[model samples]
Target: MIRGCGRLLTMRTAHRVETVRAAEAALMTRLPEGALMQRAAAGLAAACFSLLGKGRVYGARVVLLVGSGDNGGDALYAGARLARRGAGVTAVLLGDRAHEGGLAALRAAGGRVEADDPFAPLATADLVLDGITGIGGRGGLRPDAVPVARAARGSDAVVVAVDLPSGVDADTGEVTGEALRADVTVTFGTYKPGLLVDPARSYAGALRLVDIGLGDELPGVPDLEALQHQDVARLLPVPGAESDKYRRGVVGVVAGSARYPGAAVLAVEGALRGGAGAVRYVGGAADAVIAAHPETLVHPGPPDRAGRVQAWVVGPGLGDEPGVAEVLASDVPVLVDADGLRGLDPALVRARSAPTVLTPHAGEAAALLDATREEVEAGRLAAVRELAGRYGATVLLKGSTTLVCGAGAAGAVRVNPTGTGWLATAGSGDVLSGLAGSLLAAGLRPVDAASCAAYLHGLAARRASEGRGPVTAGEVAGTLGEAWRDVRAGE
Candidate 1:
């Protein structure tokens, strides 16, 4: 198994490439270029055949979208391998100078150069190999390639992108123009950034990285990371026999109001389910909080009087209450969310002595950064990191793919893979804040707590829904126990 498959699986494509390059450099001294390409071709052919089930390769029409770079070569060579097995493979050249050796190899193996009209062959092929671009390609699909990409999208055949979806930026996960949406992306050597980050990620579905035997050369650290089940399990706070409520940690929650008391209930539910030793609730909705989870210690007073909490979860349904200022002012690891983020002073957040974590959806994040919602959405990584640096806190920007970044931790942004679009429903974020706050109280660092909670929260949401339909905030909290078990079991 890969040394850290569980952990490394979450790393950005650039880091994976570094590993690939290092491995290649060490092994290149012994292996020829043709040998490496053969290995890659073998792997790609095997994967494609597996996807094809029991279907015979002979007489199966395959279309290859060839480009100028080696990505096109991978496709062409793979086309040769398939042709040898009796498949009718056709290469559609997209660039002027195609990979000469690969094109010759394909022709020698009986693969033909079909009509260059990109759209025609796509309508009938059993499978389509998108070799228009690779990790080296920048920007979106070339103008001539867009209509062809659309035609492929409309087809029923499985679309396999070589390396990554063409036109998607490899390093930044940005899509400049039209990109091919592949059913499976057969990436060579290692993963690219576009495969993990959104907009670009959406295009590269079911990614599989083919090893060209480049393993020994990667760098020590990656640019971005994704946490796996085992990683989260190892990082989770498990109390010992001697651990007491005080020792385990206390989380003070300042949330809700008379108007939206349900937010308080959900937040408290999240905190209790989050494995905190004790959850102290301080806000106007103490009655409602108590009614929901009597286990929570409710205090009907200012946040300052909440009495000794290791961490604080503020702003869930706070409704512009004056006491929220007091909660924000406290010298504790704080998680600011929801209404607590509205019209807040950045200077006050910066003045805090303790670590702070801001959890914001797109709109809330936009408001805090003084940028339009579209700007934040366009540059999620830049927006979150900017907020973390400006406030000297941890920022957990919540969306389809949540991002966790520390103010000063260089190259330490963590992208969450566990969440689903179904989590976009109301009151889900409050549960997240509570769960994150509970972990913070239980002694995990701000980024760790936030990211771990997000991973679990998303997993729980997934479990609760079971792919059927919408789930309630309460269902998410209720499913945390099973999620925790699955994480512990290393599932």
Candidate 2:
């Protein structure tokens, strides 16, 4: 994990498989047959050298898990370079067919291939280069090589994966079965979507992009992207001296029920901390909301007469019929979540001209898509895209890796890089709904509002969990101010 959200991380843009392949082909045509591979090998070798730590490359034990295809060739070539530098390198082929040229290169450089007990070198290796399967691999590790893959992962040796981790889906980030975990992955040309998303992202400890001059050939519009601190800071709503309560932004809260007023309170907490100038409450839990936040402007009845609010955050504990339809009729941006998602008509949601943002967990998303939760979780990318198109709304699929996508296929999806499992506490999504709604009220587009909110929400959760203790929804909401400061501080 990269830790804090406000720190400067290189803006990571990931492209689709077809896009990457086209770029690779374009670049390959201009370069010599082995030119790109050699460049990738050199970069991979240099990365492994730094990770070797105390031992000199002159005598360090380097083990390569060579599989079929160019992935194996890349590792074999890198291993050959390491061997030439006096490192004791060994290649363990997982399949019958290995890269012939690469095998010859390794042998010529005094590197040897292991015929048996390949796992032995992994246990005591200074570095392990995983070439098991590359970006094109599907499913998981082959049954025969699973044990060796496990051995390399469990070893004290520094693990560096070539291109991508063997079993991760390059386009979707889904991990189907047994996969190799890499401490650092040296990818050529560009970042695949899987490297930036969870499930597959968790397997890749740290990501290192090794450019092989495919930038010019790649598509201008990337498939996925992650916002850095500067980008978020630029999007945040900053109030000037002349700003007033209404001028800054007013976010209406239409949430909570008789049984779950606490959801209203949590949502209110996040709204208060959000950039919005004032929060207007228009739900059944006005008394409970006012008790927790006396400063809130409370209004009874439905959101139809909630004065003037720039944006409305509906759902949370509002149940199936919390006057959500009436609220959506307004010309302001609305964010729908929780029980509000139940029995929602896609046509009704799309009929509103205003921007609509949907914050749905895997289960809620599955329900909306009329699919199983397992199906949604397994192919989150597809589920989120389908939901976004179906409802004509910016969908934020909340989970381990929060994914934000605009209403249609052309809009580039954003994968949130912040957050922890500790953030899975109750009422957290309610807080997120409020925060994102506040951003929407503050004049940000639905995509910006949702992505920025997820960033801040995750940052707050991380700050709250500093002591490694369990965090509550309030704790996460409480840290939003500090998170906001951190974002602007970088400016």
Candidate 3:
């Protein structure tokens, strides 16, 4: 399921263009020629009819921004369905050629085909269907279609994209050039990467997947997976009757400097609620951590001086710290973040006997990859995968769409669907690192720990921000229990 927020949701599996095409080809061979298109058209029309509200289809002004391929055909056929229901449907053919049969169907349904200025029909249009380019069309929209695309955006009508939005890479979620932004995207068969990963994900406002009977033909593994509440709930650790604090798990946190004592406190705060039995704080901010969390065991200097810990979360606000190497040397899962991520040696991380997870924002990731922050943000999926491969760790690239890519597992990347804008506040990454580290200590795999931590962290941010305007890092930490309970609700 494409799980998001605090509940179970639809299948969030996304496929690449080639995978989708192969599945479609197989499905088409078993069905009638135009049957697939008809199924898609029916779903699209039903979605639009719902979007326009009850009794609004009759006399509603609908405009189709049609191009050449099946994407345009889907729009045309859906437009025909609207026309048959008494809507004033108009198809503005942007390409030189149109889908002949789709055009005929629209004409038969009394829909007008506009070959002249497309702007006139858009003025009073109640709905604009973007069908300019499909999954195969790349490098953005052609120069000829720019003005018309702008007009559609400027219109008061609800802009709906057919399949993938025009100008976005279906496989990579990259918007290389000018593209159309839609209010809602009605995708056929399955979800595409562009619809889930940002910056292309932002272009696809709200996603609606239409099952066109291709589920059976798609492969067992998908390109991406977004965890639902149930998935996260299943991964969370539950204590046994005989379990003790150490027996449960101990999370080691090496964070905060004298200048950033609050970071240690915040990290410990998150760790306490992250299903771990105990937290061990080893850094410069021991006093602050003790003051904030009296239950935490504190150490003043090096990490080896501290008691045993199942996992270590090193680096949030640790300005010029020396414990990263010491922490990495231990035979335990290590989560490196913020200051620890600075000047991290890939060979050192790669040689670790235990699993490692790296959580970096766009800027840190860009620095690590020797690329610009803009480039990392533009192509997050690629950046995260590359970081995982290079570091030999499960990399969690945090941004608008937080992604987790496991080392040596190139097939499926986990996309955190619970992320919110409010989680971008200061010390948030610190909280996330500690939480993930706690999960790791609780025996979750590096990938599962990272994914579940991100999921709960985002969900906690949402819970903290609800009816509260903006939320602080501490507030997000305070709400972790509530978010955990929300995920485990009804279980």
Candidate 4:
């Protein structure tokens, strides 16, 4: 997720409460009493120092929201360091008690505690440190701290969250009630799952990880993994000197309908740009498909006689009675999206001998899970896992935070790191479906195809949007080749 030229970054994530606690305890035993906390404080102070720009912090106002835990202590110690350097540091304690040593350190460093009217100074403050709760915090922010959090947001001051944002679930990325959003989050040790997964990830803007000696303590296998560009480039199918139309892979597109011939064209457009050698078009919109792309191999009927293909992409705008049944009956890998997700039978999906991929947005996932869209969006990790397990397929839940989940307990939920808010445009998911299906046909596993497609699709959208602008599905599809080249070059 970090942007550095000529660099490939794969950020492994762990969100389990027990896992973090265990790693912390193991490291604590090897270090001095306050060594770890001091390291965190030093790192946090440096982050704030850099954020203050080239100007000195000497008269700048820095506010700390101290809670009852070590999170508060981290903030307080960091604030003390800032205070020692001449910053006007103040702590607003929310709980009945505060970290005793942290309070002493601040007092000795010339920082004072604000017992009343914390919001008064916050309006003119230069920075606000939210140490109200640690990563272990559950549910949301308490009622008493709500106003201060709101004031911090309202003010022009830069807000820095210590560890994970308070009220955001560290494991699930579920945000309930009030949350203290930060412009930059200075996380200690390793990246928490909440920092990578969305809804909560969006709260953690511009993440910066600080090494505090927890790398050795962390386990080998992480709960989550986000695919980087090099990782995807390795999985992309490359044509060889001996390769031909049948050798590389052929993707079959069974999309669009009488009502929406444009969707078929878009799907074919995505497939053509994907690693597939050629694309086979099926369904009633053959005339429109051929008109849009003469290169497409058009078939006028069901896919049963559509000739041989390596993979099938079904759904898109194919209406209520989407011919997903006939496509699913095929032996090759099948990617289901849009209307194809309707009336889907879990048993049929589970019974398939070939790999199955389900690409769904929040609404589609909610329908399959028999849950509300809000609930699904709130718990994307849970929803994707449940769908993968229930249907025995690889599930790619698309949104601001695109995630792919694989079947089996050992499967690591892959989060797509590259995406733009502008990608929420219409027909985007159809393009994603076709692209991922084409990858599946090109010999990548279900998980790899789904994740690689998401990564490239998102990258394509970002490239199509440039730094900032509105983008359409066709525009995004048109730029897939550029995105692919960038990924390969690690640009």
* Pairs of colliding residues, candidate 3: 1-12, 2-10, 2-11, 2-12
Q: Comparing 1 and 4 by lDDT, which wins?
A: 4
Model 3 per-residue lDDT tens digits across residues 30-62 = 999999999999999999999999999999999
lDDT of 2 by residue, 1-491 (tens): 01122432456789888898888888899989999889899999888878775458899999999999898999999999999989999999997799999999999999999997898888789899999898888898889889999999899988898999988899998999999999999998888999988778888889898988988997766889898778788778888778888987999998998988999999988888888989999888889999999999999866878799999999999864466888889999999999888878999888998989999999999999999998888788888899999999899999988999997644679989888889999999999999999888888889889999999999889888998779999999989999888877872
Query: Which one wins on lDDT?
Result: 3
- lDDT of candidate 1 vs native? 0.83
Off by over 4 Å in 3: 1-11
Q: In candidate 1, list every pair of residues with a backbone clash.
A: 13-191, 19-218, 22-217, 23-217, 58-86
Best by TM-score: 3
Q: Can you give the TM-score per candidate against the true fold?
A: 0.93, 0.95, 0.97, 0.95
- Residue-wise lDDT of candidate 1 within 390-427, one digit each (tens)? 77889999987688888654565788889777788899
For all candidates in order, the CA lDDT equals 0.83, 0.89, 0.90, 0.88
Clashes in model 4: which pairs?
none
Task: Quote model 4's TM-score.
Answer: 0.95
Q: Alpha-carbon error at 361 in model 4, in Å?
A: 0.9
